[model samples]
Target: MHIMEGFLPSPWWQVWFLVSLPFIIIGLYQINKLVQEKREALPLLAVAGAFVFVLSSLKLPSFNGSCSHPTGTGLGAVLFGPCIAAVLGLIVLVFQAVFLAHGGITTLGANVFSMGIAGPAVAYLIYKVGTRAGANTYATVFVAAALADLATYVVTSVQLALAFPGTAGFLGAFSAFAAIFAVTQVPLAIIEGAVIMLVFKYIVQLKPEILTRLNLLSESTIKKLQEAAA
Candidate 1:
């Protein structure tokens, strides 16, 4: 869900920009280094960025003034890590804000924080934990993607609540916003998870080497995928 242009107050949006600035800078640095070192990742990054751009652009009406849509950063988070996901997300958000005019420059920081940073960060952590626990590849991807989507909504709700606390206080407003979005967001996240899970499954089948290069698909995981393919 995007806050749209000029929806947020001046101080709040600037604060969010300040908060997200460090992460964006660091992500840019990491992405530059990665591209310079391994040119092979460039194509995958483009695909991932495109996924986020197209998927997130397809918004469904809900969440009061805002809208709900899939924040398609899960695959990138798992494959490229959260830092790079944030960078890709920045590109997507900025493009939408500038060209499509879906969201605004003032709220770019807030949107980036929720969809780009929070969601991908949680997804990456879940991927790490799930894989280390020996979970099935698709299952882990599913959970990671689902949780990442949920995390984005959760952060968005908090940002809204803080910005515009209604008759309900902060916590109450948060709950209210979450409940309102839960109707669509939860299901959307699940569908997104399943869809991305299938895509990742194919990555495992076709270009599993990419995962190995990212250090996400370990030798054992590759073996398991190969055996299953066999």
Candidate 2:
């Protein structure tokens, strides 16, 4: 999913970077505000970021010899909120670019917007909506994570198509990539959803207090447990 340097023409790539700069700055500022408000969550965010970085480097075989890995943005967003996750994602991309050359510098802005911003934002929204509709914690996390992964790929496909508009314009190229990518991504989404559920289940069991502090455990459930303990 990471776009390579020189994959697209220089002029268009430069335009993308310039256009995405403001949004990146805004996202970073939001992350700073979140850190100020919830200093305790900073360590957790770092841990999540590291986890994502490592996971992202691991490439699983996919169709046509292409490979993919878990973005882990959904998990981060659900835990620390979308803004923080977006910032963390930028950090992850920077590291990957310098060390692994997974994504290029020229296309960093586009990559961040697609994989970092869009994934976490979509996941957080879905989680919030699902929770508000009375979905269970596991269900909310799983569905949100899955949808977030799907959204990331969708955005990436669109970016690729736009970057390489030829005889086929944006929509035509997008449709071609989307059709191929979606097949692999759909199953990837399900795997991510299950992984999130499993990780969350263990986290709740091992350190229930953290869940309360994070506001992830439902208030109603917490109250019932407190009453039972008393």
Candidate 3:
């Protein structure tokens, strides 16, 4: 969910902006490097951006200015990596803010941090662990996508609590925000996971070499996929 426009106080928003900027720069560099290396990956990158934009833009109603939606960063993280995911997520957020009126400029950094950096990072880690654990391809992708989406809301709740620690204090406010978001976000995340898994399955069937070229598909994963197909 976006923290909404003008919701964050001064300094807090500025702090987030400063913090997220470097990640975006790094993300840009990573993307450029990927492009130079694999020109064919351009279509996949575009699809990842579109996924983030479509999924994240579907806002659920909020009590306060904030609203919840799927971060959609995990798909990009799996297809590319966390750095590229962050860049894609940032672009989606900016587009949403300008045209959709969902998120605002004041809260862009906080939104990007939760949706772009934090969530995608978690997704990348989960993917690594899942593969190491020998989880099936679908299950691994699903877990990564779902957990990443949840992580985004968790970080968003924390950011909100930090910005406005009410009488109940930071932890209390954070819990409250998290609980509220869980109602809508959990289901959305599951859906997101399923969608990503299906998309990945289609990609695998169409062009398994793409993942191999990106260094994403390990030999073990390839063997598992072949076994599953067989």
Cα deviation of 28, candidate 3, in Å: 2.0
TM-score per model over all chains: 0.89, 0.85, 0.86
Prediction RMSDs, each to the true structure: 3.2, 3.5, 3.7
| Stretches of candidate 1 exceeding 4 Å from the true structure | 39-44, 58-68
Candidate 1: C-alpha lDDT: 0.84
- Candidate 1 local lDDT, 1-230, one digit each (tens): 77898888867999989888898899989888988998876887888798778877776444444456677887777778788888898899999888788788889999989988999999999988988888887888899999899998899899989998888889999999889877767877887788788878788888887778768878787888878878
Better-scoring candidate (TM-score), 1 or 2: 1
Query: Which lDDT tens digits does candidate 2 get at residues 153-204?
Result: 8988888888776688888999999998898788878777787777777766
**What lDDT does model 3 reach?**
0.83
TM-score quality measure for candidate 1: 0.89
lDDT of 3 at 134: 73
RMSD of 2: 3.5
